[model samples]
Target: MADEHRNEHAAPHHITPLTTYIFVFVARAAGTLLTWFASTVDLGWMNTPIALVIATTKAALVILTWVVVIGSFVWLGVLFVLTFADYLTRFWAIY
Candidate 1:
């Protein structure tokens, strides 16, 4: 009876296949290389946007692979708010 109860309350184990891990690893490595390459190229006004997109993509991959989806979204929401707040304040010196 105790064993049965323990099993019932235990969280299910999710086993990520080796191929999934390998795929993520390769993707992250590619992202790293892209970032390095991006730094060397001067794209004028487009540089920051391009780098941000690549970085965000890399971050999303890691979050999706290792974090619970809902939790990651919540965290991302908080970060977005904080970043927006900082951006909004950046122009304060001009005022």
Candidate 2:
């Protein structure tokens, strides 16, 4: 029974809108490369914003790709909200 179920589900269940996935991968890869490039530059104030943007983009891609809980859209929404809140709070002095 377990083997039967496995066989049924193992047939390459791909997500739709393949373009979106491609874009996500490209953005994440670009962000990673930018982060690496930024590390070698001595821009002082500019570094924080660059790093934050890269980190936020990478985090978003990860959440979208791997953390989609089954029947738990609310949780995903909350995670997104929290992630955005963190991103916003990082670059500025928030009271």
| Among all candidates shown, the one with the greatest lDDT | 1
- lDDT per residue for candidate 1 within 1-95, as digits (tens), equals 65655767678889888998899999989998999999999999989999999998988887888788897789889999999999977878776
Backbone Cα, N, C clashes tallied per candidate: 0, 0
Error of 1 at 12 (Å): 1.7
* Runs of candidate 2 exceeding 4 Å displacement: 1-15, 62-95
Give candidate 1 misplaced runs (Cα > 4 Å): 1-6
Each prediction's TM-score versus the true structure = 0.74, 0.46
lDDT scores in order? 0.88, 0.80
RMSD of each: 3.5, 7.3
**What is the C-alpha RMSD, rounded to one decimal, of candidate 1?**
3.5
